[model samples]
Target: MPAPVLLPPTSYDYVTVHKVQGTTITAASDILAAEEPLEIRLGFGPTGQREHRTLAITMRTPGHDFELAAGFLLTEGIISRRQELHGILYCPDVEKVEERENVVRAELASTVPVALPRLERHFYTSSSCGVCGKTSIEAVQAAACPVLPTDGPYVAAELLHQLPERLRAQQELFEQTGGLHAAALFSPEGELLLLREDVGRHNALDKVIGAALLQEWLPLHQHVLLVSGRVSFELVQKAAVAGIAVLAAVGAPSSLAVQAAHNFGLTVCGFLRQGRYNVYSHPWRIVGAATAGL
Candidate 1:
């Protein structure tokens, strides 16, 4: 059978809608954040013996498909170092010229190994939640991901409150459709390193991490990850895999997310809006957190 052809993502769609104010109704055009399936495939094996196999299909806002594929692979423990990856490319079959660029084939270094059985087990992830219906922390930890480092780069309470606003300002897609998730990576000095938006919060984050990985920025021990919405276990797990020190969310976090953060030594903060936020774990990273708790 022929391999599946992945197509490029459509970031948004234009459609007509009705607007009602008081008692009057009017028709108008509106924009929507585009959502589409992105199939991630891994290409591995000896030179002429290399082959392509589907890894996972996720719904994400179109654009940055390659970064998303790379990030997903990294967080999934499939590939770690940028050196381990050769390149993520679009299929170049002259016969399939009309194919959408959504399908990405990640070619790993010939020296890098491929674990087919383990890779297949994680192909069922969705855009909504990385750990949907997942039983325990162990289920998420099956990736053999490393623990996050707990050192310097302690952020200030003032900065933590400012992250949501910083992330919000960079949300270009959300500004247009008011319907997209954003994930941003920030330096300890509160500098925005990368920002990515997606229909799924998890996918948005994957793009951010993928971008960093593509640039050989793994083991982000001095970095902070800010998401536009609530944090989930999957998000924390992904951060841990990348060695992020801090994970902050604009909204609340799930119990599992808190536990994951606590377990992995990641500082998880949530409800990060209106100049107030809660530190779920590793409160020491936030300046004066102990004083705040008192």
Candidate 2:
């Protein structure tokens, strides 16, 4: 057995004394979120043959760390299914633990090398939005994913407005400091299923996806994924990998995110507040809502 890797302490700052309305007032703040460097390490073999490699570094909350790594591998197109993972463990080196305890390595059971180049379209925290440069519309078309095949049930407008509050209520870490992002899964009836919070928005999404994969509930094309922040291309790609058809966010969706959703035949909605939301991609699935007939 290897030694457990201990991550550094994390806290979010939410209290601030600021002048408001010409008076200094103590207020709840959101800037003091926990930020920690988490390193994902790759591990292989059972004992003496074990090998390790530093995969990617990400800033995120410390909880559910294993799920985050698994999700990252999936979205990167390195491993599509949960069964591919041989084992995930903390590094055994004592010196390595002190210097890089946050580091985690994954070992694939198969001998086939996972190609990172195929993941050029995948976005990690360290990669810029458009680092791949411009591609001809046709070239972009070639990389597009097809629409999800599933029968979607109708969701109501009031249910859409209630999701943010539901997700907020479950964010244990965020409630303490108000500095983390959350990703949640909801049934067609707007019931909350699972929610994960992380310092990095992408990490949160990955955790939720990883959880879904472990439960064999993947290809979530029938359910909905809700985020507490704006939608990004990276988020869209993760959703696409899980076959999630509907992605709703509390903020805005980037141009590339919207394009990615449309390319994948997903329904992208943003600015979900006060019973109103803007649908960016396919809207036909949201039946019975005021915007459904439109």
Minimum summed lDDT over a 10-residue window in model 2 is located at 127-136
Question: Against the true structure, what is each candidate's TM-score?
Answer: 0.90, 0.79
Query: What lDDT, from 0 to 1, does candidate 1 have?
Result: 0.80
TM-score of 1: 0.90
- lDDT per model vs. reference: 0.80, 0.71
Q: 242 in model 2: Cα distance from truth in Å? A: 1.1
Roughly what TM-score does model 2 have, to 2 decimal places?
0.79
Native-to-model Cα distance after best TM-score fit, residue 179 in candidate 1, in Å:
0.6
In Å, residue 269's CA in model 2 sits off its true spot by 0.8
Question: Per-residue lDDT of 223-277 in model 1, one digit per residue for the tens?
Answer: 9899988988888888888888898888899888887777778898888887778
State the displacement of the C-alpha of residue 61, model 2, in Å, after optimal TM-score superposition.
Answer: 1.4
- The lowest-lDDT stretch of 10 consecutive residues in candidate 1 is 1-10
